[model samples]
Target: MSFKNYAFYDKIMLSKPVTVKGLTFISVVGITIQAYGKYGVFLWSTITPKALIVVDSSGDISFYQISNDTATSELLESITLLFAEE
Candidate 1:
């Protein structure tokens, strides 16, 4: 998926989302990819959009797109991260 322009804290409504193990995966939220060699990607956001993204050390990604106001979801590719290259 490509990077999308979204307003901070504004949630996105997805019609179709990827389902993994009976769980709907969505929220392809763009993160500020911090470049650090050995440590891998570092993400530190004070405030972000409603959709949440969890990334592990192995570059493994888990998308939690459900918004706080209303539950939500979206579709995403395997370990595909979209953001500004730092």
Candidate 2:
């Protein structure tokens, strides 16, 4: 009697789904910044002339209207770090 080869009968398992909630949040914040720059530039500019339109080394543009408010400035810095290229 000859034995049949069962080596080809191995089951393939699919990979688990990855959760990108953090990435999604970052993306949303980035988009919000862009929109604010495009539409709310005038409003913010009037409130704070220290507005910044930064084009990083990667050519990514970000807008920030910073004031004497440390909390707001810190939050903006955190958002910038999030979208920064590694």
Q: Which candidate leads in lDDT?
A: 1
Local accuracy of candidate 1 as per-residue lDDT tens digits, 1-86: 33434333332222335655555544443333333334344333332345555445455667565446434423233222222221
Give each model's whole-structure lDDT.
0.41, 0.35
Please give each candidate's TM-score: 0.25, 0.20
lDDT of 2 by residue, 1-86 (tens): 43332232221111222234322111112111111233233221112233344444454656555444435465556546655733
Candidate 2 ranges with C-alpha deviation above 4 Å = 1-50, 67-86
Worst 10 residues of 2 by lDDT: 24-33
Among all windows of ten consecutive residues in candidate 1, which has the lowest summed lDDT?
77-86
